[model samples]
Target: MKQLIFSLSFCLLAMSSLFAQGIQFESGSWADVKAKAKAQNKPIFVDAYAVWCGPCKWMSANSFTDASVGELYNSGFISYKFDMEKGEGPAFAQQQSIRAYPTLLFFSPDGELLKKAEGARDAEGLISLAKPYLKANNNANQEQTTTDNNWESLNAKAWEYYETKSNRSDLSKALKWANTSIEMNRNWYNLDTKAHLLAKLDRNKEALELAVDAILAAQDAGELAEAEETMELLRKLRNN
Candidate 1:
């Protein structure tokens, strides 16, 4: 009987250690955690809990501490835990439309809500809930990178033709490349390139409109140099 009890205790200790490691939740304000997520370009995982909730405590002691949960959450997400009833938590919960204890919220890097759930999840369930959002965000980031690369190449091609400007045909080709790039991304650089190409094609009105758009996009992106350049181009277009 004594040996059996000792064996049971050892087994329990081993199991505890097996699942001891878990998600490393960030200790920061909601704004700070959101900023970190944006900086890392990773999705945010918010554990909205209350001290009085049984399931919240269960998850804090079990599911959140599981090794697999830690591995996935730590690697793929900017994790945070907030008490729904304390500090900034109440305001955040109100803003997020959190209505229940142990609310699981996933947000994009830009702070858009991606997914939400109420109640506690087991380790496997939590992992399952999070995997799709992470995968979707990763895919979106990859696609945007690829699209940006393609737009850069097209923009470069357009610039080469614009620099040459040997004939009307060359100008037309430059406009085509610029149009393609703008279609891929309406970023300030591409929009400015398109505006200049339109100006070369003697479409002054369209060029002015595109230049304005470029300025606005630049302002949104905080690209002061691009905005300045677009302003100069806008003046030139207006003069024409």
Candidate 2:
């Protein structure tokens, strides 16, 4: 009976180890990390934790090590682990308004803060928390054929998915978003984003027209950065 129980325990231990596929965190200075995320057009996932926190350790050992959680987060965002008490973590934590251990923060590529969830959770729980953000990520380009496409929802989704578009279809969706956004509000941001998306998708003729128009309008509106950036985009597109 004793031998049989020992054998069962060993098997269980091995099974547990097999299932624990730990997450891999990227290493770099905070600025470089953010820049890389922006360049890749991916959202940032920060696992804000402290070394002394038991829940933090538990998550690192269990939740974060789960294969399901690792797969979901790895594909969905550029993940980082920050020790809230160490290095640049303190100031960042303060800025992010983190007062507890194991705060999961998601940020858009444009440095806009999206969600901040506090406390530790299992793999399923964590993924559930991140689900909406993930949907928003892809749906930004999804064809909005339904009357349900309100301007606030559309614009919010566009901002969330802006740089994080995955493929050519997404790029096309971004064009749709840009056009729809112009219909809703022909303001500088919408126009500028539309022109930028056009240039990115190599839809040159319209891109050039819109880019020039945007540059002129932005300059007239005294938005120098938008004007200059759009001008540079126009130049780049023309050269390419």
Candidate 3:
């Protein structure tokens, strides 16, 4: 009974070790990793390490397996581990100019190198190094969201005036709002709105030009559905 219990305990221990949570490193080419990062809107964290490096092995066995490290890296980054002395790893290391044993590289979603660090770090040290970049990225995303919201609100207000068309004065006010919206973001919807406002105000030539721009912008954004109205407007403007 005692031997059986010990065997069971050993099996449990082995299972736990096998399933231990850590930085979930992806298996793929560098291009695949970058593509995934772009799709997920997450940064890339590359562990450029060598097989014979003591520090690199120590980090892999200790710090990377820490739960906190796993949570942060797995969530915020598309992590990859490359053996710098083997296979395509040598070429990649050369390209990235990695000369050290355990170089940490942080890249933006678009694959721009954002940060680089050399040497191995404990879990706390690694977390501390990564936190600021993630925080900054989060803050930037929030600011962009706010800007988009503000521009959308402005566009809606402008469109309201366009729909009402109570007077020439209202059209003029709508034009101002539309211009501001376009300045904030020269996207198809706002461009279309501005073009319509210009047409209402009898600025046919400017309106036609803006309509064309809107159509092209819509196409570029893969928002061709929104371009149909703009196309119709362009046809009318050409006839006039």
lDDT of 3: 0.83
lDDT of 2 by residue, 175-228 (tens): 666677778867666666777776666568878888877877787788867467
The residue ranges of model 1 lying beyond 4 angstroms of the native Cα positions read 1-20, 150-240
Candidate scoring better on TM-score of 1 and 2:
1
Clashes of each: 0, 0, 0
lDDT of 1 at 37: 86
* Pairwise lDDT winner, candidates 2 and 3: 3
lDDT of each: 0.82, 0.75, 0.83
User: Per-prediction RMSD in angstroms?
Assistant: 13.7, 12.1, 14.0
Ten residues in sequence with the least summed lDDT for candidate 3: 140-149
Model 3, residue 51: what's the lDDT?
A: 83
Alpha carbon deviation, residue 110, candidate 1 (Å): 1.1
TM-scores for all candidates: the values are 0.57, 0.55, 0.55
Over 79-182, each residue of candidate 1 has an lDDT whose tens digit, in order, gives: 99999898998999998888989999987776767678998899999999999877866765654455445788879877777778655444554565677788
